[model samples]
Each structure stands twice: as structure tokens, then as C-alpha cells.
Target: MCRWLAYSGTPIRLDELLYQPRFSLIDQSMHSRYGVETTNGDGVGVGWYPADSPAEPALFRGVGPAWNDANLREIARSTTSPLFLAHIRASTGTAVQQTNCHPFRHESWLWVHNGSIREFAKLRRDLLLAVDPALFPTIEGSTDSEVMFHLALTFGLRDRPVAAVERMAGLIEAVARTHGVPAPLQMTIGTTDGDRVWGFRYSSEGHSRSLYYSTETAALQRLYPDNPQLHRLSEETRLVVSEPLGELPGAWQPVPESSYGVIQKGADELGHFEPAAP
Candidate 1:
């Protein structure tokens, strides 16, 4: 339903990923080849760690569509960071408002997603009630994405990311099933604590939303030996996106349907994930 990308590596110009690629995130906002929709123009957000400070990331988000937002374009060109999160939204039953956009922040963490709750309204009340009281007041949006964020926080995401996320999925699925919502909750979530990045792709059913991660740096270097831009990157630089930004046939690999991946300083680690209760 949406498009997003998480990058961890050497500090590079934002334009390097959002504008320079053959099928950049900006380009995808106007022309997406594999997302549920061809256009994701409801809103956009970018979160990055400033070079001078790695623990806290600065986030800029707006209600306007990405392609038409000059401010977004300008920032993409001017800002640079080693770890960043970017999202282009295609609202699913939510208003096209700035708060509804993603890369939602809490202290040193940032998160984004590319899917929706099967019947969010039916379970919103119950889900909201389950959030940690301290974090509940901080949730400023109505999208399932934000709800999911709060859920993770409630489960202690800041302390145990993997387990918290697993609990989040479990809670979401349980509520959905109790309300009679069918299986297959399409979800592809990316989260970062300004250091390590975690990307998840899963559904209640076997098939989930499309998600891909770049090949290991050394492998990519071998494949694109003649490309200086690629060679300049360290053996650890890596990318995880909802869809491949370019048609680099061998550059991207699909994340297993029921799996989650972790990236730290450009290195990737992957594992299987169980569906939420539903």
C-alpha cells in the first residue's frame, strides 16, 4: 500500500538514494512498479541521524504528496546521514494529514510501515487500551502504523526489539481474529534505534507485502565492479526497501515471506517470524 526505504551505512547525500537511483523513492511516488498502488502521494516523511549526534534522529514530515513538495526535494538534496528512514504514503482508510504520515519517532527510535490493519476500527479501542500509558499520550496519529508503533513500545521495543515486535504482531492478529477479520495482514515494517535497523515482512497468510534487501556489500562490489559509486561504499553499507528502487536484477533479494531482517552498520541478519495471534 505504500513505499519506504531504510538505509544504514556511510554518510551520503540524501539525493543519492531518494533522487539519483534509476527508480528512486521520489520516482516511485509517481510510478511504482510493485506496490499495491501505482502512486503513494498522500504524504511523505524522512528521519535521519545528524552527523554530530547519532542517538537522536531529526524527522521532517508533511501532508502534501512527495512529488509536489519542494521542501522535501530541497531537504533530500541538502541533508546527509549514515542512517536514515524515508516513507511515501498511500493512505488506507486514514486522513491525508501530516501526523498520519510515518517515520514516527519516540526518543532515539524511528519507524515506518507499508500496510494496514485488516479492520482497524473494530480493534482500535482494544489496541489503544493495551499501549503503555506513558507512551499512549505521545501517539499523535490514527493510522494502524502508529498503533503498531505504540504496541511495540508497550511490549518494550526500546529494550528488546525482536521480542517486542513479535508481541506486537501477536497482539494485532489476536484482536483481528477476535473481531472476525480474515487472515493475511499485509505488513512490511522498518524500525531503527539510530544504530541497528530491523525490517519485517509478514502476513497472517503465507503471502505478505513485497520487501527486499540489498545483497551483501562484498557481493554487490563483485557484481558492479566497474561502478565507482558502489565501490566507494564500505563492505557493510546496506539497504532495505518495500520494492527495489532500480531494475538492478541482481542487486535486490526478496525477504522471505514470513521472515524479519536486521541491519547494523550495513550488515544484514535475517530470521523467521511467527504471525500475530489472528
Candidate 2:
């Protein structure tokens, strides 16, 4: 299990969200409230799309505990972006290396995941083989999370994200069935193409990991007019996280089980999610 957060709208310093909240991602790295593990210190990574238009997102990753890393702190304090993703990993079996950390990138897209494929070791070979040959060469790590990212790309993530992910999940389950495994997927994922961000919560079994999205920014500002942070963000600002960052009573909404959410420049959407055959 792991923890992550994706933010869109309003260019703000990373530290404002990564460290300023009561239960910020930095705090979650050492004391998570909903993740399977409280300490996700195996590694940490951040990817952000600059405020400038049509630019490739920049990335920074470290194979170290985020709470203890001076470089991470400095970067968070100095950089700002309109869209960004931050992740702290808790390896399910992969080596603890920088490349294995999340917020994986390809072209302009950035992705992160907070759960694992059940018994990934059994399905690894088949899953790897199923990836598009062109993408296979770009996979730099051995985590099921990274492989899932590539599989999504192979299935047309750039052109049709939601369906590609559905197909990826379907294929994983199909392969798992052939190997006598059950409940093959468990994930709370965040992905963006430097424009809109998509978040999902799903598993082969009924139960999935925790995922949540913030209430509309303008509404929150009205409720807590005295809260300066709320005022700093624009009406389009939104966040999708592995858990609530603060205990603001009406500020966070749990993503419905087996569903997907999209956060964009204007209106957002939450739609039923189902895995279809690839």
C-alpha cells in the first residue's frame, strides 16, 4: 500500500499541499491513517506540469524516506505548478529504487497508484508479455504499478484513458484466471495528461482501497471564509488523494466504491467504473 495526491488548478508551491495540511502527504509518509501501512518510506516521487502551456511535466524521485530528505523539502519549498502529483511508496515486493517510485511519466502523462495486483508474481510474466513492444522498452522498473501504467498506454490511454484502464484491468483478471488466481487487482489510481486528471478506485473483489476527492473550491471558501488557503485557490481547483488531508467536515468526499472521477478546468465528473474485456 502507498499514499498519493493529485492537484489541479492554481499554481501553488508544492510544499503548500505536501507539508501545510494537518495530514499532508509528508505526514502520511510517516503516519498514514487509511493506507494498509502507516509508513510508506520505501521511496517518494513528484511530477508536475508547469503553469506554462503544452510543456512536458518535470519529475523528481528519491529512494528515501520523504520526511527525512532535505532535497525533497527544498524542492517542495521552491517549485510551483498548476497540476502536480506526489507519491510515497510502500513496496509490495519490488526493489526500493528511485525508478520504482510512483508518479511515473510518459510523454506528457503522469500516473500514480496506491494498491497492488494480488499475487502479481504469478501473473508478472503474462502481464509483461501483453504490453505493447514499443512500451516494453520504456519500462524501467519491476513494480506491478509501473507495468500497469504501460499496459494502460498500450490500450490507448492518450486517446481514451478510461477505457484503456478498464481493458488493462480486464486483461490482468483474465490472465489471473488462467493461473488459478482470484481477485487479481486492487488499486486507487491517479493519472493526468497535463490537462484533466482521472482518479479511480477498484478491485477484482468488491472491496477496494480508500480514495477521496475534495469538495468544490469556491464552495469550501464560502464555508470557511476565514481560511486563507481556501481563498488562494481558484474555483476550478481540485484534489484527489489516497486519504483526506485535513479533517474539514465537508471538504472531502469519499470516491464511491468501483467508480472513477475526473477533475478538469471547469465541471468535474464521477462515473461508474467497470472492467470490460480487452
Candidate 3:
């Protein structure tokens, strides 16, 4: 599995979370504490929404370990975004290439995932065949994560995200069952459309990968009374990650297994998540 994070709220420099945190994504790239593999150096990618452009988010990706990427560090220090998704890849039987990096994009949406479809080799063809014919040509990589993004798009992610993802999961499981694979899916996914962000945690056998979201800014401020930065961020600021970015007490909350949630301008919403009929 990989490591990833989705930030939504105030427009801030990427390094604020990517490099500055105690256990930042850059640190996770080489020494991840919670991922299946300690080193996720297969590839790395970052996607962020520019303040002036709402139609699509810009992406920067490379087929190198993030910790050693000078360009990544340069970009992280110079760029800022209101919303962004960053990922450090650990191949789950996929090639190490830019196309296989996470934070895959389609129009206004950006997506990243931290897990895989068990025995993808057994069901890859079937799953690809399930994607809408029009959308198939747009799939640029062979990784299950990118394929899963297109599957959600085919299932109507733009207008109905949660349901679209649920349908996508359903299709993966249906194909897996036909292939005799007991557990077909394992994912901790994050997706956004330059505005709101949605995150999901689920797997076929019930125990999914670890995922967490930052505690509300209000709570953090109270917990770290002397930390002025905590009080500067909006109360609506939120971060969903494969693991907590830091060890600050009460600064993160684990996302419950088999659930999904939305992060928007106001109050965030969390609810049960389950595959539905495709």
C-alpha cells in the first residue's frame, strides 16, 4: 500500500503538510510507520487547485522517491493551493512509472488511493471492460488505483460521488467473485473537485487500511493553546490522510472502517459506506 493526504480549506503552501509536519508525507515516503511497506519510493505525485482556475487542478508527478526529488521540494516550497492531494507510491504489482503515480486527474477532479484490489491480475481485464467505452481511452495507466478513478467517473462521480464510488466498488467485487477471489478490494481513497473532498475506507474482508482526518481547528487550538498557527487556520480546515501527519495530542481522528465522509465549506459529514448494486 501507499501513503497519501488530501487537504481542503485555506490556501497554503504544500510544504506546510508535505514537508513541515513532524511525520510529513516526505518522511513517510522513506519511513512510513503505518503503511504495509515502510518505503513507498516507486513514485510520487501532487495535484492542487490553483486559486484562479476552477476547471482543473494542475499535477506534478515523477518516477522517483519523493524524499530525493529536488523538483518536489522546490515545488512544495514555491506552490500554494486551496485544495490538494499528495501521494507516495509503493507499487502493488504495478510498474514504477509516472503514469502509475497517484493523484490521477480527469477534468476538475483529482484522486488518490492507498490500497489495492486483491489479485488484480485475475480481474483486471474484466474490470477494464466494465468502464464506460468513452472513458476507457482516457485511462493512462495500468494501476488498479487509476482504473478505480475512471470506474468512478464512468459510474457518475461528478454529480453523485458517494454513490458513484459505491457502484465502482460493487463492480470490482462482482468481477472478483466471478474470478473466485475471496477479497476483491482494499482502499482508503481521497478525491476532490476543486471544491469539496470525499474520502472512503473499505475492503472486502472488513478490515481496511488505516486512514485519518485532522481534528477540527477549534479543538486543536484548545489543545495547543500556545500554538498560534492553530488559531490562524479556518475552523473548516480539514485533512484526510493515510496516517496522522504528526503526533500532536488530539490532532487527528481515525476514520472508521467501512465509512466515507465529505469535507466542504461548513460542517463536515461522515456516514456509513457500503458497495451498492452497479
What is the TM-score of each predicted model, taking all chains together? 0.97, 0.98, 0.98
lDDT of each: 0.89, 0.93, 0.92
How does model 2 score by TM-score? 0.98
Candidate order by lDDT, decreasing, is 2, 3, 1
Over 31-94, each residue of candidate 3 has an lDDT whose tens digit, in order, gives: 9999889999999999999888867799999999999999999999999888999999999898
Off by over 4 Å in 3: none
Candidate 2: regions farther than 4 A off: none
**RMSD value for candidate 2:** 0.9
Candidate 2 local lDDT, 1-278, one digit each (tens): 89999999889999998999899999999999998999999999999987776469999999999899899899999998999999999999989998899889999999999899888988999999999999999999999999999999999999999999999999998999999998889999999999899999999898999999999998999999999888988999999999999999899999999999999766798999999775
Which stretches of model 1 miss by more than 4 angstroms?
265-267, 276-278
What digit string (tens of lDDT, one per residue) describes model 1 on residues 1-278? 89999999888989899989989998999999998899999999999999899998999998988889999889989998999999999999989898999899999999999988888888899899999888888989899999999999888898988888888989888887778888726799999998899999888876788999998878888987898988989888999998898887699999988888889754367998875442
Over the full model, what C-alpha lDDT does candidate 3 score relative to the true structure? 0.92
Candidate maximizing lDDT:
2
